[model samples]
Target: MPHFAATLRTGLCATVLATALLGLAGCVVISPFGGHDDQLRETTVQGDGDSKILWLPISGFISDAPSRQAFGLVQQQSTLATVTRALDKAEKDDDIGAVVLRINSPGGTVSAADEIHARIQRYHETTGVPVIASFGGVAASGGYYVAMAADTVIAQPTSITGSIGVIIPSVNAKGLLDKLGVEDASYVSAEHKDIMSPLREASPQERRIVQDVIDSLFARFVSVVKAGRPNLDSNHLAEITDGRIFAADDAKRLGLIDRIGHIDDVLALARDKAGVDEARVIRYYRGRSAPRSILAEAATGSGMNFSAAGVPIDLSVDSNAGASQPLYLWQPPGAP
Candidate 1:
């Protein structure tokens, strides 16, 4: 009887927890305990009008794969998926006057950034809506790459932008393996199959092959930047494209960004370009209610997660957390 009673109590508590979670309507809830609704809810963040200024974010490590949480209980939308979803909705909404991309990232994989950039470019071309990029926190490398699709890029006074280049991180563990008396017995079908293998030091030919690939990617990056910023000086191109981060002030001076201002300034510029004086500034959220402020939500693209009960389930870990691939990322001296 006691065991049965305990079982009944456990079941009742779970039922109550589920009921409480379902009843939550005025707060953002990203929970592992609940299934995600595919539908995105639109909420007016600021102003009031028939027209809308969509606030789309490109934050964290940009990747095309669905974000895998640390707990692996739920899979969140990929950065590319989020962008695609938002743009898909924007395309259907005729009242969307403009799009403001709020970017805050150190960058991610090469393909993800390129795909996002292409999507944004296509969306802008098809809709003819003025797209503006608003840099927040640290928008470097792939973050800046994705922003190239924006008609005008604006950086906050304290924002860090730039770091243009490609990086394919590699390590040589031959010495370590020798000291540990371990051997790399893995064999390849072709000589160049394991070109940049970490098991051994790269040969001259392998290094050249890798360098060629990096050079090609770098060239593409330059072309994208040139297309976006026509006013970017040719002389400054060399210095700017050398893969280094810059403050907002220097970015503007180098013509990497148009202006240094706040989110209000970005919104105002977007409004002016869209020719809307009093449009509703809005953003899409998966949860029940929109966040109180534009910055209230956590980093959008980094795969951070929280529960419906207001407990943070996953603060780190992305789908592409650890992988050897070409990336347009900015990892400072000690950055993880």
Candidate 2:
């Protein structure tokens, strides 16, 4: 135990020294050994054939901004950036039979999701490659938005999707501030510069402006869904677009999803659609070790979060980092 403690101390000291040296030199370095170069290495998941199927995963918070990891020592590439890189790589490979997107997320910022959706749509149009979306646990709001780009969508039996809507989260801290005798006294140039300020109740005019913005975004969301799902019963359009979630069965029935199936089933459909009898399932990743199987994720550490006093430091940042950033998200109360 003593030897282990000494080793740990030495490692910490070395990290501190390196950090200091780099800071003094006005240079930022993620790792001394290697860094992310946006170069993706392919790891075959399963099967053996001349053609290949790319198993791309769209998981967690879909953000365009790069995520900080290893206590900001490493920058995990953004989901948008990764998608761009993956599609770029896939387009160059002629042997690529099809692209299967494994989506599992509650959703994120409107801009990020919309941008990814647009890119995928453009990719399919340009390459003529069949894009299939396979929903996992949850594919709500922005998650569903990106799936619009897919030629076909297959959801697991227990998958939860829909929640087709827009949201701009804001907090009202006026009551809390009153209890603490704190006041908001910031100066602004315009009459409604602080439109969604939490310090005070918004005027009717401000409320109207915010509602107008929401309505505009909602209209866009509906339009995107219409373009994606042509067979969707127009009669049920009002019911489906009421910001409610739907199960896999309901989604399929509502024409939001095409079929319900497992990963293997999705793969088979993909291979059949691409007219390939046999094909290797591949995953593109940026890391040192290769994934042992399709389900295995990269070994990239999220990052250490311990302070000198052994207290956990909150180093993570949410996609909604501002006061009133608009989103196409489906984050319910108590959701992570």
Candidate 3:
């Protein structure tokens, strides 16, 4: 009877936990861009019907767009896709006044980051409204790249910033596969055809080819930085080319960040620049309600069980991207 009761209790607890989690997942944030209590989304013309600040967050090694229905109640917050959608909604909203990009990311994929940055640029060119970037805890690499599009960037004194470089990872797991006794019998037409397979070693010449590609990409990164922060000394183009992070104050001193202040300060700047003292601060995250996988949820766990089976998405960080971090990146690996 005691054993049966224990089993029953365990089963009941599992059911309850699952039920609660599902309920939590159900509270999906339909649209982060949705104006507070309002039905429609579009900026108002004829001198500010009502000032609204759209908050967009770009965090972590961003992957694809988040889904709103993936979770039951609790949903994902600010993502790159959500930010883009928010800008779109805010653009047409007859009530919103300006946008405040709240950056709290260590950078993500280059193409995704570029897409966000380009959208911001488009918003700036098309709309006469002002856009400001407010840095949170840390925003480096692709994070800073996106923020550069903002008309004004505000950061706290110790905020981590910079990391302005580009790289594509090249992995050679031939030895590992050999040790595991995993033979890839798959056949390809060309001798160098197996380049896409991580099981094979990269040729010496291939290394040079990869390096050249990275160098070209790095040049592009510099070009974008120069164009965005034109006020900086553009003469010594290669001086700060190495990948590195910087403190908020140092970033400001280097002409990378505009001011040293918190998110509230940045919001004030957005309001002032948009020419409105009163406005609502809003956010947009489409399909962002999906619950994080158990493994991902426990990414911060000291003894959290992180099994490959429990993970939903495979987050990747290019090794080259880490090594080539421009001389201006702010990352706190073991920070509390």
Cα TM-score per model: 0.87, 0.88, 0.68
Candidate 2 per-residue C-alpha lDDT over 219-255 given as tens digits, one digit per residue, 9 for 90 to 100: 9999999999998888899999999999988898889
Task: Quantify all predictions' global Cα lDDT against the true fold.
Answer: 0.85, 0.85, 0.62
Q: Tens digits of per-residue lDDT for model 3 on 116-212? A: 8888999878886777888877788888888878888888877887777765544567788899998778787976666545677778876676677
Candidate 3 shows a clash count of 46
Residue pairs with backbone overlap in model 1: none
lDDT by residue for model 1 (29-140), tens: 3443455556777888788889899998888899998865434434578999999989998999999999999999999999999999999999999999999999999999
Q: After best superposition, candidate 2 residue 149: deviation in angstroms? A: 0.6
Q: Candidate 2 at residue 186, lDDT?
A: 79
